[model samples]
Target: MFIQSFLLLLAISFLSAGRVPRPEERIIGGQNIEIEQAPWQVSLQVNGEHICGGSIYSNDIIITAAHCLYEKERRLEAKDFLIRVGSSLWNSKGTLVKVAAIRSHENYNSTNFTKDIAVMRLSEPLNFTDKVKNIPLAERNPAPGTVAMVSGWGATSIYPKHSYPVHLQGVDVPILTVDQFSISAGSNGQTACYRDSGGPLVVAQQLVGVVSSGYKYCDGPTQFISVSDERSWLLNAIASIKL
Candidate 1:
Protein backbone atom coordinates (compact mmCIF):
# COMPACT_ATOMS: atom_id res chain seq x y z
CA MET A 1 0.00 0.00 0.00
CA PHE A 2 2.87 2.38 0.71
CA ILE A 3 4.51 1.69 -2.69
CA GLN A 4 1.16 2.04 -4.37
CA SER A 5 0.69 5.34 -2.54
CA PHE A 6 4.20 6.46 -3.58
CA LEU A 7 3.57 5.76 -7.24
CA LEU A 8 0.30 7.59 -6.92
CA LEU A 9 2.21 10.56 -5.52
CA LEU A 10 4.87 10.30 -8.24
CA ALA A 11 2.35 10.27 -11.07
CA ILE A 12 0.99 13.58 -9.82
CA SER A 13 4.50 14.92 -9.27
CA PHE A 14 5.20 14.98 -13.01
CA LEU A 15 6.27 18.64 -12.71
CA SER A 16 9.65 19.59 -11.22
CA ALA A 17 11.21 22.43 -9.24
CA GLY A 18 14.31 23.67 -7.38
CA ARG A 19 14.82 24.03 -3.63
CA VAL A 20 11.59 25.76 -2.60
CA PRO A 21 11.07 28.03 0.37
CA ARG A 22 8.99 26.99 3.36
CA PRO A 23 5.41 28.25 3.70
CA GLU A 24 6.11 30.74 6.53
CA GLU A 25 9.24 32.23 4.91
CA ARG A 26 7.37 32.86 1.63
CA ILE A 27 4.72 35.06 3.20
CA ILE A 28 3.34 38.17 1.45
CA GLY A 29 2.78 41.26 3.67
CA GLY A 30 -0.81 41.55 2.55
CA GLN A 31 -3.63 42.02 5.03
CA ASN A 32 -5.43 38.92 6.23
CA ILE A 33 -8.22 38.25 3.76
CA GLU A 34 -11.63 36.79 4.43
CA ILE A 35 -13.00 33.61 2.87
CA GLU A 36 -15.83 35.47 1.15
CA GLN A 37 -13.89 36.33 -2.01
CA ALA A 38 -13.40 32.65 -2.56
CA PRO A 39 -16.79 31.64 -1.26
CA TRP A 40 -16.44 28.30 -3.00
CA GLN A 41 -13.74 27.44 -0.51
CA VAL A 42 -15.20 24.90 1.91
CA SER A 43 -14.53 22.42 4.66
CA LEU A 44 -15.58 18.92 3.70
CA GLN A 45 -17.39 16.99 6.42
CA VAL A 46 -18.13 13.31 6.63
CA ASN A 47 -20.60 12.37 9.35
CA GLY A 48 -20.11 15.84 10.84
CA GLU A 49 -16.38 15.30 11.00
CA HIS A 50 -13.94 17.54 9.16
CA ILE A 51 -12.23 15.33 6.61
CA CYS A 52 -10.75 17.80 4.09
CA GLY A 53 -11.36 20.96 2.11
CA GLY A 54 -13.01 21.83 -1.23
CA SER A 55 -14.20 24.72 -3.44
CA ILE A 56 -17.59 25.67 -4.80
CA TYR A 57 -17.91 26.36 -8.53
CA SER A 58 -21.65 26.84 -8.92
CA ASN A 59 -24.66 27.02 -6.66
CA ASP A 60 -24.63 23.25 -6.45
CA ILE A 61 -21.41 22.18 -8.09
CA ILE A 62 -18.12 21.76 -6.19
CA ILE A 63 -14.66 20.66 -7.34
CA THR A 64 -12.38 18.64 -5.09
CA ALA A 65 -9.84 15.82 -5.21
CA ALA A 66 -10.72 12.19 -5.88
CA HIS A 67 -8.50 10.84 -3.11
CA CYS A 68 -10.25 12.98 -0.52
CA LEU A 69 -13.46 11.14 -1.24
CA TYR A 70 -11.73 7.82 -0.78
CA GLU A 71 -9.97 6.75 2.39
CA LYS A 72 -8.64 3.23 2.68
CA GLU A 73 -11.50 0.83 1.95
CA ARG A 74 -13.99 3.49 3.04
CA ARG A 75 -15.24 5.41 0.01
CA LEU A 76 -17.56 8.23 1.07
CA GLU A 77 -21.22 8.24 0.14
CA ALA A 78 -23.08 11.42 -0.87
CA LYS A 79 -25.23 11.33 2.23
CA ASP A 80 -22.17 11.08 4.40
CA PHE A 81 -20.63 14.37 3.23
CA LEU A 82 -21.47 18.00 3.98
CA ILE A 83 -19.79 21.13 2.63
CA ARG A 84 -19.29 24.10 4.99
CA VAL A 85 -18.66 27.28 3.06
CA GLY A 86 -17.59 30.86 3.94
CA SER A 87 -16.16 30.38 7.41
CA SER A 88 -12.55 30.39 8.43
CA LEU A 89 -13.39 28.56 11.64
CA TRP A 90 -14.70 25.01 11.55
CA ASN A 91 -17.40 25.13 14.22
CA SER A 92 -18.87 28.38 12.95
CA LYS A 93 -22.27 27.98 11.38
CA GLY A 94 -22.17 28.62 7.67
CA THR A 95 -24.23 27.61 4.70
CA LEU A 96 -24.50 23.85 4.84
CA VAL A 97 -24.47 22.36 1.36
CA LYS A 98 -25.41 18.72 1.37
CA VAL A 99 -23.82 16.79 -1.45
CA ALA A 100 -26.52 15.42 -3.69
CA ALA A 101 -24.13 13.76 -6.09
CA ILE A 102 -20.44 13.04 -6.52
CA ARG A 103 -18.67 12.46 -9.83
CA SER A 104 -15.10 11.28 -9.92
CA HIS A 105 -13.14 11.39 -13.14
CA GLU A 106 -13.67 8.19 -15.14
CA ASN A 107 -9.91 7.77 -15.59
CA TYR A 108 -9.29 8.15 -11.86
CA ASN A 109 -7.60 4.91 -10.84
CA SER A 110 -7.00 4.90 -7.07
CA THR A 111 -3.46 3.60 -7.62
CA ASN A 112 -2.58 6.69 -9.71
CA PHE A 113 -3.00 10.43 -9.12
CA THR A 114 -3.00 11.60 -12.75
CA LYS A 115 -6.70 12.40 -12.77
CA ASP A 116 -7.34 13.24 -9.15
CA ILE A 117 -10.40 15.40 -9.50
CA ALA A 118 -14.06 15.13 -8.46
CA VAL A 119 -17.23 17.19 -8.45
CA MET A 120 -19.99 17.45 -5.84
CA ARG A 121 -23.48 18.69 -6.53
CA LEU A 122 -25.42 20.23 -3.67
CA SER A 123 -29.06 19.56 -2.83
CA GLU A 124 -29.92 23.25 -3.19
CA PRO A 125 -28.40 26.52 -4.33
CA LEU A 126 -26.18 28.05 -1.69
CA ASN A 127 -27.46 31.44 -0.53
CA PHE A 128 -24.86 33.85 -1.82
CA THR A 129 -24.05 36.58 0.66
CA ASP A 130 -21.10 38.61 1.89
CA LYS A 131 -19.89 35.56 3.70
CA VAL A 132 -20.59 33.11 0.90
CA LYS A 133 -20.20 33.24 -2.87
CA ASN A 134 -18.79 31.13 -5.70
CA ILE A 135 -15.21 31.20 -6.87
CA PRO A 136 -14.76 32.21 -10.47
CA LEU A 137 -13.85 29.38 -12.80
CA ALA A 138 -10.60 29.61 -14.75
CA GLU A 139 -10.97 31.85 -17.78
CA ARG A 140 -7.74 30.67 -19.43
CA ASN A 141 -4.72 28.59 -18.68
CA PRO A 142 -2.37 30.10 -16.14
CA ALA A 143 1.18 30.59 -17.32
CA PRO A 144 3.98 28.47 -15.93
CA GLY A 145 5.89 30.19 -13.10
CA THR A 146 2.74 32.02 -12.15
CA VAL A 147 2.32 32.45 -8.42
CA ALA A 148 -0.87 31.11 -6.92
CA MET A 149 -2.57 31.28 -3.54
CA VAL A 150 -3.85 28.41 -1.40
CA SER A 151 -5.67 28.60 1.91
CA GLY A 152 -6.81 25.98 4.35
CA TRP A 153 -7.56 25.42 8.03
CA GLY A 154 -4.67 22.99 8.34
CA ALA A 155 -1.52 23.07 10.40
CA THR A 156 0.65 26.18 10.31
CA SER A 157 3.99 24.41 10.29
CA ILE A 158 5.29 21.12 9.02
CA TYR A 159 6.49 19.91 12.40
CA PRO A 160 6.03 20.45 16.12
CA LYS A 161 2.49 19.15 15.84
CA HIS A 162 0.23 22.07 16.70
CA SER A 163 -3.42 22.92 16.64
CA TYR A 164 -5.06 23.69 13.30
CA PRO A 165 -5.40 27.38 12.47
CA VAL A 166 -8.53 29.01 13.84
CA HIS A 167 -8.68 31.26 10.79
CA LEU A 168 -7.71 30.00 7.37
CA GLN A 169 -3.96 30.01 6.72
CA GLY A 170 -2.90 31.31 3.31
CA VAL A 171 0.26 30.63 1.32
CA ASP A 172 1.58 31.90 -2.00
CA VAL A 173 3.63 29.55 -4.17
CA PRO A 174 4.97 29.97 -7.69
CA ILE A 175 3.63 27.57 -10.21
CA LEU A 176 6.47 25.15 -10.97
CA THR A 177 7.15 24.53 -14.63
CA VAL A 178 6.05 21.01 -15.55
CA ASP A 179 9.66 19.90 -15.72
CA GLN A 180 10.56 21.68 -12.50
CA PHE A 181 7.67 20.27 -10.48
CA SER A 182 8.14 16.70 -11.76
CA ILE A 183 11.84 16.57 -10.99
CA SER A 184 11.94 18.31 -7.63
CA ALA A 185 8.85 16.51 -6.38
CA GLY A 186 10.70 13.14 -6.73
CA SER A 187 9.20 10.34 -4.60
CA ASN A 188 8.92 12.79 -1.70
CA GLY A 189 9.86 16.36 -0.90
CA GLN A 190 7.43 19.26 -0.30
CA THR A 191 3.74 18.92 -1.15
CA ALA A 192 0.25 19.26 0.29
CA CYS A 193 -0.45 16.55 2.82
CA TYR A 194 -3.16 15.48 5.24
CA ARG A 195 -6.24 17.76 5.53
CA ASP A 196 -5.48 19.73 2.38
CA SER A 197 -7.00 17.37 -0.13
CA GLY A 198 -9.56 18.88 -2.52
CA GLY A 199 -8.54 22.45 -1.65
CA PRO A 200 -8.26 25.12 -4.32
CA LEU A 201 -5.14 26.50 -6.00
CA VAL A 202 -6.05 30.04 -7.00
CA VAL A 203 -4.33 32.18 -9.66
CA ALA A 204 -5.50 35.72 -10.37
CA GLN A 205 -8.64 35.03 -8.37
CA GLN A 206 -9.53 32.05 -10.50
CA LEU A 207 -9.52 28.37 -9.67
CA VAL A 208 -6.52 26.73 -11.35
CA GLY A 209 -5.55 23.68 -9.34
CA VAL A 210 -7.04 21.29 -6.86
CA VAL A 211 -5.06 20.07 -3.83
CA SER A 212 -4.23 16.39 -4.29
CA SER A 213 -1.17 15.07 -2.51
CA GLY A 214 1.90 16.45 -0.79
CA TYR A 215 4.79 15.26 1.38
CA LYS A 216 4.18 13.57 4.71
CA TYR A 217 5.22 16.59 6.79
CA CYS A 218 2.68 18.92 5.14
CA ASP A 219 5.42 21.24 3.96
CA GLY A 220 8.08 21.12 1.28
CA PRO A 221 7.04 20.85 -2.35
CA THR A 222 3.25 20.82 -2.68
CA GLN A 223 1.57 18.93 -5.51
CA PHE A 224 -1.69 20.06 -7.00
CA ILE A 225 -3.81 18.56 -9.78
CA SER A 226 -3.81 21.19 -12.52
CA VAL A 227 -7.20 22.51 -13.56
CA SER A 228 -6.08 23.83 -16.95
CA ASP A 229 -4.59 20.47 -17.85
CA GLU A 230 -8.02 18.89 -17.76
CA ARG A 231 -10.00 21.77 -19.28
CA SER A 232 -11.90 19.97 -21.99
CA TRP A 233 -13.15 17.18 -19.79
CA LEU A 234 -14.15 19.59 -17.05
CA LEU A 235 -16.05 21.77 -19.49
CA ASN A 236 -17.95 18.82 -20.85
CA ALA A 237 -18.78 17.63 -17.37
CA ILE A 238 -19.96 21.08 -16.30
CA ALA A 239 -22.08 21.52 -19.41
CA SER A 240 -23.73 18.17 -18.98
CA ILE A 241 -24.89 19.05 -15.50
CA LYS A 242 -27.77 21.40 -14.69
CA LEU A 243 -26.78 24.19 -12.33
Candidate 2:
Protein backbone atom coordinates (compact mmCIF):
# COMPACT_ATOMS: atom_id res chain seq x y z
CA MET A 1 0.00 0.00 0.00
CA PHE A 2 2.81 2.40 0.86
CA ILE A 3 4.63 1.59 -2.35
CA GLN A 4 1.47 2.16 -4.39
CA SER A 5 0.88 5.51 -2.72
CA PHE A 6 4.50 6.55 -3.31
CA LEU A 7 4.33 5.64 -6.96
CA LEU A 8 1.18 7.67 -7.48
CA LEU A 9 2.74 10.69 -5.81
CA LEU A 10 5.82 10.36 -7.95
CA ALA A 11 3.73 10.33 -11.07
CA ILE A 12 1.90 13.46 -10.00
CA SER A 13 5.15 15.24 -9.27
CA PHE A 14 6.41 14.44 -12.72
CA LEU A 15 3.20 15.61 -14.32
CA SER A 16 3.24 19.12 -12.89
CA ALA A 17 4.33 22.38 -14.72
CA GLY A 18 4.75 23.82 -18.26
CA ARG A 19 1.57 25.04 -19.99
CA VAL A 20 1.75 22.06 -22.33
CA PRO A 21 4.51 19.70 -20.99
CA ARG A 22 4.31 15.89 -21.47
CA PRO A 23 2.41 14.49 -24.48
CA GLU A 24 0.42 17.71 -24.20
CA GLU A 25 3.25 19.99 -22.90
CA ARG A 26 5.59 23.77 -23.33
CA ILE A 27 9.06 26.24 -23.18
CA ILE A 28 11.94 27.08 -20.78
CA GLY A 29 15.72 27.83 -20.81
CA GLY A 30 15.37 30.55 -23.37
CA GLN A 31 16.37 34.19 -23.61
CA ASN A 32 14.58 37.24 -24.85
CA ILE A 33 14.82 37.85 -28.57
CA GLU A 34 14.51 41.16 -30.39
CA ILE A 35 10.86 41.51 -31.31
CA GLU A 36 11.82 42.41 -34.86
CA GLN A 37 13.48 39.04 -35.35
CA ALA A 38 10.14 37.26 -35.08
CA PRO A 39 7.85 39.04 -37.50
CA TRP A 40 6.15 35.76 -38.32
CA GLN A 41 5.47 34.71 -34.73
CA VAL A 42 1.99 34.89 -33.21
CA SER A 43 0.25 34.30 -29.94
CA LEU A 44 -2.80 32.05 -30.27
CA GLN A 45 -5.49 33.23 -27.92
CA VAL A 46 -8.73 31.79 -26.63
CA ASN A 47 -11.50 34.24 -25.80
CA GLY A 48 -9.00 37.03 -25.13
CA GLU A 49 -6.52 34.80 -23.32
CA HIS A 50 -3.13 33.80 -24.67
CA ILE A 51 -2.84 30.01 -24.69
CA CYS A 52 -0.41 28.93 -27.38
CA GLY A 53 1.95 30.09 -30.12
CA GLY A 54 1.83 29.96 -33.92
CA SER A 55 3.49 31.13 -37.11
CA ILE A 56 2.13 33.29 -39.89
CA TYR A 57 1.99 31.62 -43.29
CA SER A 58 0.61 34.44 -45.37
CA ASN A 59 -1.56 37.52 -45.08
CA ASP A 60 -4.45 35.32 -43.96
CA ILE A 61 -3.16 32.04 -42.62
CA ILE A 62 -1.46 30.81 -39.44
CA ILE A 63 -0.13 27.39 -38.47
CA THR A 64 -0.41 25.95 -34.99
CA ALA A 65 -0.90 22.71 -33.09
CA ALA A 66 -4.17 20.80 -33.35
CA HIS A 67 -4.33 20.29 -29.59
CA CYS A 68 -4.62 24.03 -29.05
CA LEU A 69 -8.11 24.01 -30.54
CA TYR A 70 -9.84 22.01 -27.83
CA GLU A 71 -10.89 22.28 -24.25
CA LYS A 72 -11.98 19.08 -22.46
CA GLU A 73 -12.14 17.35 -25.85
CA ARG A 74 -14.56 19.96 -27.22
CA ARG A 75 -13.24 21.80 -30.25
CA LEU A 76 -13.51 25.55 -30.06
CA GLU A 77 -15.31 27.61 -32.66
CA ALA A 78 -13.79 30.33 -34.81
CA LYS A 79 -15.58 32.93 -32.70
CA ASP A 80 -13.75 31.75 -29.61
CA PHE A 81 -10.31 32.29 -31.14
CA LEU A 82 -8.09 35.22 -31.98
CA ILE A 83 -4.42 35.81 -32.64
CA ARG A 84 -1.92 38.48 -31.67
CA VAL A 85 0.71 39.25 -34.24
CA GLY A 86 3.55 41.72 -34.77
CA SER A 87 4.47 41.99 -31.13
CA SER A 88 6.93 40.39 -28.78
CA LEU A 89 4.52 40.34 -25.90
CA TRP A 90 1.65 37.91 -25.92
CA ASN A 91 -0.64 40.23 -23.99
CA SER A 92 0.16 43.67 -25.33
CA LYS A 93 1.73 45.42 -28.34
CA GLY A 94 0.54 43.01 -31.04
CA THR A 95 -2.25 43.49 -33.57
CA LEU A 96 -5.26 41.36 -32.73
CA VAL A 97 -7.36 39.64 -35.39
CA LYS A 98 -10.28 37.26 -35.43
CA VAL A 99 -9.92 33.68 -36.63
CA ALA A 100 -12.17 32.86 -39.58
CA ALA A 101 -11.58 29.13 -39.88
CA ILE A 102 -9.41 26.25 -38.65
CA ARG A 103 -8.51 22.95 -40.33
CA SER A 104 -6.67 20.17 -38.60
CA HIS A 105 -5.45 16.97 -40.21
CA GLU A 106 -8.25 14.43 -40.55
CA ASN A 107 -6.26 11.76 -38.77
CA TYR A 108 -5.17 13.91 -35.84
CA ASN A 109 -5.32 11.79 -32.67
CA SER A 110 -5.71 13.39 -29.28
CA THR A 111 -4.58 10.29 -27.43
CA ASN A 112 -1.05 10.20 -28.91
CA PHE A 113 -1.16 13.68 -30.46
CA THR A 114 -0.20 12.41 -33.88
CA LYS A 115 -0.68 14.72 -36.85
CA ASP A 116 -0.76 17.59 -34.40
CA ILE A 117 -0.68 20.31 -37.01
CA ALA A 118 -3.46 22.78 -37.92
CA VAL A 119 -3.90 25.75 -40.20
CA MET A 120 -6.11 28.76 -39.59
CA ARG A 121 -7.53 31.47 -41.77
CA LEU A 122 -7.90 34.94 -40.41
CA SER A 123 -11.07 36.95 -40.77
CA GLU A 124 -9.08 39.47 -42.73
CA PRO A 125 -5.66 39.66 -44.27
CA LEU A 126 -2.90 41.23 -42.24
CA ASN A 127 -1.33 44.43 -43.45
CA PHE A 128 2.17 43.18 -44.01
CA THR A 129 5.12 45.37 -43.14
CA ASP A 130 8.53 45.09 -41.57
CA LYS A 131 6.84 44.06 -38.35
CA VAL A 132 4.56 41.44 -39.85
CA LYS A 133 5.78 38.93 -42.39
CA ASN A 134 5.14 35.33 -43.32
CA ILE A 135 7.45 32.45 -42.49
CA PRO A 136 8.24 29.97 -45.23
CA LEU A 137 7.48 26.32 -44.61
CA ALA A 138 10.31 23.81 -44.96
CA GLU A 139 10.02 21.23 -47.70
CA ARG A 140 12.47 18.94 -45.93
CA ASN A 141 13.41 18.32 -42.32
CA PRO A 142 16.81 19.32 -41.04
CA ALA A 143 19.28 16.59 -40.29
CA PRO A 144 20.05 15.53 -36.75
CA GLY A 145 22.61 17.69 -34.87
CA THR A 146 21.50 20.87 -36.59
CA VAL A 147 20.65 23.76 -34.29
CA ALA A 148 17.21 25.19 -34.63
CA MET A 149 15.38 27.86 -32.71
CA VAL A 150 11.88 27.95 -31.20
CA SER A 151 10.13 31.03 -29.89
CA GLY A 152 7.14 31.64 -27.63
CA TRP A 153 5.72 33.52 -24.62
CA GLY A 154 5.85 30.58 -22.27
CA ALA A 155 7.31 29.73 -18.89
CA THR A 156 11.00 30.48 -18.38
CA SER A 157 11.24 28.33 -15.32
CA ILE A 158 10.97 24.56 -14.93
CA TYR A 159 9.42 24.74 -11.46
CA PRO A 160 5.77 24.02 -10.66
CA LYS A 161 5.27 27.75 -10.25
CA HIS A 162 6.13 28.87 -13.77
CA SER A 163 7.71 32.17 -14.63
CA TYR A 164 6.25 33.60 -17.79
CA PRO A 165 8.29 36.28 -19.45
CA VAL A 166 6.27 39.12 -20.86
CA HIS A 167 8.52 39.35 -23.91
CA LEU A 168 9.08 36.59 -26.41
CA GLN A 169 11.86 34.12 -25.69
CA GLY A 170 13.86 31.78 -27.90
CA VAL A 171 16.21 28.89 -27.34
CA ASP A 172 18.63 26.99 -29.52
CA VAL A 173 17.91 23.28 -29.67
CA PRO A 174 20.02 20.64 -31.31
CA ILE A 175 18.06 18.21 -33.38
CA LEU A 176 18.08 14.66 -32.09
CA THR A 177 15.97 13.02 -34.74
CA VAL A 178 13.65 13.68 -37.65
CA ASP A 179 11.93 10.39 -38.16
CA GLN A 180 8.49 8.90 -38.68
CA PHE A 181 6.86 12.25 -39.43
CA SER A 182 8.14 14.06 -36.32
CA ILE A 183 11.14 16.13 -35.29
CA SER A 184 12.62 15.62 -31.83
CA ALA A 185 15.03 17.96 -30.05
CA GLY A 186 16.56 18.83 -26.68
CA SER A 187 17.54 16.52 -23.73
CA ASN A 188 21.23 17.33 -23.83
CA GLY A 189 20.32 20.20 -21.48
CA GLN A 190 20.70 23.09 -23.92
CA THR A 191 17.11 23.31 -25.20
CA ALA A 192 14.40 25.82 -24.89
CA CYS A 193 11.24 24.49 -23.35
CA TYR A 194 9.05 24.24 -26.47
CA ARG A 195 7.11 27.18 -25.08
CA ASP A 196 3.40 27.09 -25.86
CA SER A 197 2.06 24.56 -28.30
CA GLY A 198 1.92 25.56 -31.95
CA GLY A 199 4.89 27.93 -31.95
CA PRO A 200 7.35 27.77 -34.81
CA LEU A 201 10.59 25.84 -35.02
CA VAL A 202 12.81 27.59 -37.46
CA VAL A 203 15.97 26.73 -39.36
CA ALA A 204 17.50 28.90 -42.05
CA GLN A 205 14.42 31.12 -42.20
CA GLN A 206 12.14 28.19 -42.93
CA LEU A 207 9.39 26.77 -40.72
CA VAL A 208 10.47 23.20 -40.10
CA GLY A 209 8.51 22.30 -37.02
CA VAL A 210 5.41 23.07 -35.00
CA VAL A 211 5.66 22.83 -31.24
CA SER A 212 3.87 19.58 -30.40
CA SER A 213 4.84 17.71 -27.21
CA GLY A 214 7.48 17.19 -24.56
CA TYR A 215 8.03 15.65 -21.17
CA LYS A 216 6.52 17.31 -18.10
CA TYR A 217 9.98 18.38 -17.04
CA CYS A 218 11.97 20.76 -19.24
CA ASP A 219 15.19 18.72 -19.17
CA GLY A 220 13.89 16.11 -21.53
CA PRO A 221 13.31 15.59 -25.25
CA THR A 222 10.79 17.82 -27.00
CA GLN A 223 8.78 16.71 -30.00
CA PHE A 224 7.48 18.80 -32.85
CA ILE A 225 5.12 18.02 -35.70
CA SER A 226 7.25 18.19 -38.82
CA VAL A 227 6.12 20.78 -41.31
CA SER A 228 7.74 18.83 -44.12
CA ASP A 229 5.88 15.68 -43.19
CA GLU A 230 2.57 17.51 -43.44
CA ARG A 231 3.47 19.74 -46.36
CA SER A 232 0.97 18.25 -48.77
CA TRP A 233 -1.91 18.53 -46.36
CA LEU A 234 -0.84 21.98 -45.36
CA LEU A 235 -0.78 23.26 -48.91
CA ASN A 236 -4.17 21.72 -49.59
CA ALA A 237 -5.61 23.16 -46.40
CA ILE A 238 -4.27 26.58 -47.27
CA ALA A 239 -5.53 26.50 -50.81
CA SER A 240 -9.01 25.33 -49.80
CA ILE A 241 -9.58 28.09 -47.27
CA LYS A 242 -11.00 31.39 -48.45
CA LEU A 243 -10.16 34.51 -46.56
TM-score of each: 0.78, 0.87
User: Clashes in candidate 2: how many?
Assistant: 6
Total clashes for model 1: 18
lDDT of 1 by residue, 36-58 (tens): 65566788877666667788787
Top candidate on lDDT is 2
Could you give candidate 2's per-residue lDDT for residues 99-142 as a string of tens digits?
99998888987656689889999999999987799999999999
Please identify model 1 stretches exceeding 4 Å from their true place.
Answer: 1-33, 179-191, 239-243
TM-score of 2: 0.87
Model 2 CA deviation exceeding 4 Å by range: 1-26, 192-195
Candidate 2 structure lDDT? 0.77
Candidate 2: clashing pairs of residues: 20-25, 21-25, 21-26, 27-193, 27-195, 28-193
